[model samples]
Target: MKKLFTSYLDTFKGLSKEIWWLALITLVNRAGAMVIPFLSLYLRDDLGFSLSSVGWVMTCFGFGSLFGSWLGGILSDKLGYYKTILLSLIATGIGFLGLQFITSFWAVCLGFFALITVADMSRPAFFVALSAYSKPENKTRSLTLIRLAINLGFSAGPALGGIIIASIGYYGLFLADGITCILAGFLLIQTLNPKKAKEVDQEQLVENPLAPHKDGLYVIFLIALALFGVVFVQYFSTVPVYYKEVRLLTESQIGLLLGMNGLMIFVFEMPLIAYMERRGWNLIGNVIGGLLLTGLSFLFFYIEGWPGVLVLGMATATLGEMVAFPFGNAFALRRAKLGRQGAYMGLYSMSFSLAHIFGHNSGMQLVNSLGYNLTWAIMGLITLLALALLFYVKRRANTLKI
Candidate 1:
């Protein structure tokens, strides 16, 4: 264990100050990630929306993201990551503010799409900024650190959000979430001055313009990863409704359960990644193992009567996330062509958002028609197919003479 600790230390050896600040920014922004976790609940319990309506609203968020992710990449490449991040954050906060007033089905759905589109547009740009701020050897570790911060913040978001809802009500939740997002944006403005950020962007690779759409193998990889995302998103879309409606868990109890995922990732992700790297484990193998575990974790939901079993399942899924996400990010970063960092990463981010669209829509429909158990079972099966395809793609990815 001590040796593993040392390996974890090794991963952070040469990170720049900028990288640390970026992580801080991520933590601050994600800590306010209170809205999405309880969105289905809010719509269902508060506004009396059906599960199908909740799913459709969530899908709108994803659809907006599809556009936002691509546009964010372009802006990051043009305006620099600093500006793109700043603007997206502020816009997203405004979007949430809009959500505070709108309750009609079309109004809420449209607001959410606009909000997601603006907010998510920063993702690719943020990826580019993160990559630029780290040493080449520390790429995966850097991404993991950023993810660690995200989860750490997420750990707090749901629990705190639950308390907020109990104390101040649902609109208060929207207000608080909006404020923090905009705060993160302004913080970027204060820290990443134009002169400093411009110099940094000048040193980075130029845009590849056509790489994301044109690269055949990378496109195949995106499709596969997106499929995996379709399965992954059910954690937010369908799982909470299941817990509340089927298992009769309270909001606080539900918060604890979801928070468990973030907490596990916060505490264990880096060390696990460090251990795997030191052991000289193959990344493709790690990804495949993660994917299988993800499938099995969802499959564990088949154990209907035991809450402990569900906890175990969430724990297992976090382990899968730790394995797959960093390696996949590192893989994408490595694949970016000269000058196309923003475009490629944006495309990658877009693929995941696209998955949210499919996942929410389909998962909700399955819930209505097939019952909860079969819904989860089908999701697990989808992951199995994705896992197989990902393995084949990993082999192909390895052979590509990039």
Candidate 2:
């Protein structure tokens, strides 16, 4: 037991203090990320919006994310990651604080679009910062550490968010979200000078970094990523509705269940990643396996009538997430040459943004028309398609020496 504990602890070693600081900032920001998980419920129950209406609003949210990601990439390259991140954090905080004032449907749609656009601008900049702060060899573990912080914060956020929502309503949730983001921004400004971080080795930099749009294989990889995101994001967008309506769970109960995903990742993911990294396993192959597990998670929903099946499905999906996301991020980062890291990471973030645009609205529309079982089935089929595309990417990457 002692040896086992030490081994688990060992996985966390060798990361720089800057990485830890970055992780801390992420933790603070994500811990207040209570709004999005409950956005659909708030729209439906509080504002009396229909499921389809909620879907449209969320689609607008996706469009905002798409634009923000592109802009962030450009800013990260032009202004540097530090300024880009700091600006995004402060702007996103102010946006969230003001968002609660817009109540009408169209106004709400516009509000969400504007808020998410500013908020997601942080994504690519954050990735570029991660690269700047960590050693080349430790990059994957560094990403895993940041992900752990995010999951840890997410695990706590939802549970507390449920309590906050129950006691003070959605306004309190928004207040918390805004305050935390601002606090994180201040924290970033106070600690960690970006100037002192490790510089990209000139010799290692690609002389001609391929533009992401022009890279066919990378585009294929992005499509697969977007599809995987479409399947995965259903947990956030539609699964809560399924929990409330079908399982008849309360807001608190739903929060706990959702929080379980982060808890599971926090407990297991780092160790698993360490083992995988040590083995030098193929990143794409691992992603393929993760996608398969994610697909099977949805298949469990087909059984129905038993709420435990929901738990099982969530577990399977979380395991798949743990396996796939960090490695996928590392793979993307590795593919980016130093000069154009911002563009590559931006497109990488955009794939998920694209997923957000189509995933939520489509899932909700399908559920409204076909019900949960069929929706899950369709998501599984989508995963299969994503997996097939990934196989092609793997082959092409080998052939192209990418």
The CA lDDT of each predicted structure is 0.84, 0.91
TM for every model, in the order presented, reads 0.94, 0.97
Candidate 2: tens digits of C-alpha lDDT, residues 1-402 = 999999999999988888899999999999999998889999998889999999999999999999999999999999998999999999999999999888999999999999999899999999988987788888899999999999999999989989999999989888999999999999998875565555442336678778888877778989999999999999998999998998899999999999999999999999999999999888898898888898899887678677798889899999999999998998898888634999999999999999999999999999999999899889989998999999998888778766
Error of 1 at 119 (Å): 0.5
RMSD list, candidates in order: 2.2, 1.4
Per candidate, the number of residue pairs that clash is 3, 0
Task: Score residue 118 of candidate 1 by CA lDDT.
Answer: 93
- Please list all clashing residue pairs in model 2, or write none if there are none: none
lDDT for model 2, on a 0 to 1 scale?
Answer: 0.91
lDDT of 1 by residue, 341-398 (tens): 8889999999999988889878988998898999988987888788878777778867
Scored against the true structure, residue 220 in model 2 reaches a CA lDDT of 90
TM-score, prediction 1: 0.94
